[model samples]
Target: MSIRARLLSTIAGQLGNPHGTLGKGVAFMLNRSNHRAIAGAVEATGVTAGATVADIGFGGGAGLSLLLERVGANGSVHGFEISPDMLSRARSRFAGEIGTGRLQLAEGPMTGLPLADNALDAAITVNTMYFVPNLDAACTELVRIVRTGGSLVVGIGDPDAMAKMPFTAYGFTLRPVAEVIAALERAGCTVDHQQLANPPIPHHLLVARPA
Candidate 1:
């Protein structure tokens, strides 16, 4: 990793949590317009209370925490992150929820989540798809884990915006949102909603359902 990536990795490992830590940075990076657009798409899909949700590439755990709050005590949320450092912070931050068995954090990539097929009610990934080496495999894995009626929410900032960001100064290429949507559709996920917002940053929110 470059110096910048190493620094970000360190920071993410140290401060990220299940609440709003990493998300604050994400929100700031995306600016207000894109943030609202992504939020609107999520709300439209209806995560609902008591749903079994999984947040893939759950960076500081902000989205997962939000889902937790929405799902309430009767619901469950599972978070998956490949970064061991990030996973540690998330575990510490959500200790109470984990202890209560309402939230579970796994240290792994979304492509190989240790979950049963058709077990989740919903799942979401925000601005993390760019780092995935195999988008097709990742989408397949997502489809396998989500139930027939379950939803997959994906949000990605514009590649141009990301390239101009400090993180990309190190070495990160933004993934094409159009290609991602096409891949998801090829995997048999029905596209339920799609939205694009350009403000803080250009972003696209695509909500898909398992067929």
Candidate 2:
């Protein structure tokens, strides 16, 4: 492969799941860049105290911490991450919460979340959909896990803008906003809210509830 192709492939791999030393570096970058989107996703969930929620692809645990705060001391937060490096970082960062039984981090993919049916009051995933191989299956899993009346929020960068990013030319599935909403609706979720964040590369947050 060309040097540029190889570089993009490496970056795509890291984004999918950070691994060793290099993975750690990539995880740090992702945590920094995804902050606003993560915050927007957590807020979009509208979770409250005592609510049980999960943060899908909780890179570096930053968003997980935010979700924990929103759910308060009485609630629980579950983190789903496929990347070993990211998962390790999250476990270390939230050690206190794990020890106290308020948080659990599981290593797994979104297609088959290691959670029970109707087990969550809400769920949120930020900037992770582009990496999922089967978007429909992932959406179905979300519907299966979140109970009726429960909410789900997914955040992603605008595809048009993201497409302009050089790295996205490699192995990225930049779905249109309408397609995403349609997939969620077909999965039995009712689209409830939508928002676009501030700035040049505005992020999109879509909130839905089980139909």
Candidate 3:
């Protein structure tokens, strides 16, 4: 690969599967940059105290804290992540909650969340869709994990806006907003769409429930 191509691949790989010190740095940046979108996703999940919720692909764990708070002390928050580095960071960062059994983090892909069917009251995944190789299978898994009458909030950067970024051309698989909604619908979920008011890069949140 060309030097520039290699560099862009490295950056995108870090975003997709953070590793080492540089990956940790990228995770920190993602935590900050994705803050607004994560907040909106957590809200859309409609989690209540004492409920069980999961943050699928909880990159940098920005949404994990929010989900924990939404579920409160009596509730449970589980996190599934593809990156072991990110999972280790969360294990250290949320040790108190882990010790108290209020938070759980596991290393796994979204397509195979290791949880039983209807294991969650609500679930949300923020800013992690582009790396997923199989959207249809991932959507099916999301439907399987969340209970009937429960909610699933998926947040992603706008494809048009993401396309404008030079680095995204490397490893990102930016999908159209409509294609994502259709994937969820095919997975047996009724979907709703919302756009956050973030500037520069628009963020889309898809709220889905079992139809």
Better of 1 and 3 by lDDT: 3
**C-alpha RMSD between model 2 and the true structure:** 1.3
Better-scoring candidate (TM-score), 1 or 2? 2
- 1-211: candidate 1 lDDT, tens digit per residue: 7777798765443322322365456434433334454455456557888989887776655666677887899999999887665677678889999999999999777788999999898888776676676889988988889898778888777777777766454334467777888888987898754656564566677888888
Residue 206 local lDDT, model 3: 99
Model 2, residue pairs in steric clash: none
Q: Order the candidates by lDDT, highest first — what do you get?
A: 3, 2, 1
Local distance difference test, each candidate: 0.72, 0.86, 0.91
Cα displacement (angstroms), candidate 2, residue 185, comes to: 0.3
Q: Per-residue CA lDDT of candidate 2, range 139-198, in tens?
A: 999888998999999888899899988788777899998888888999998896566665
For model 1, what is the alpha-carbon lDDT of residue 126?
75
lDDT of 2: 0.86
Candidate 1: regions farther than 4 A off: 1-44, 166-170, 196-199
User: Which residue pairs clash within candidate 3?
Assistant: none
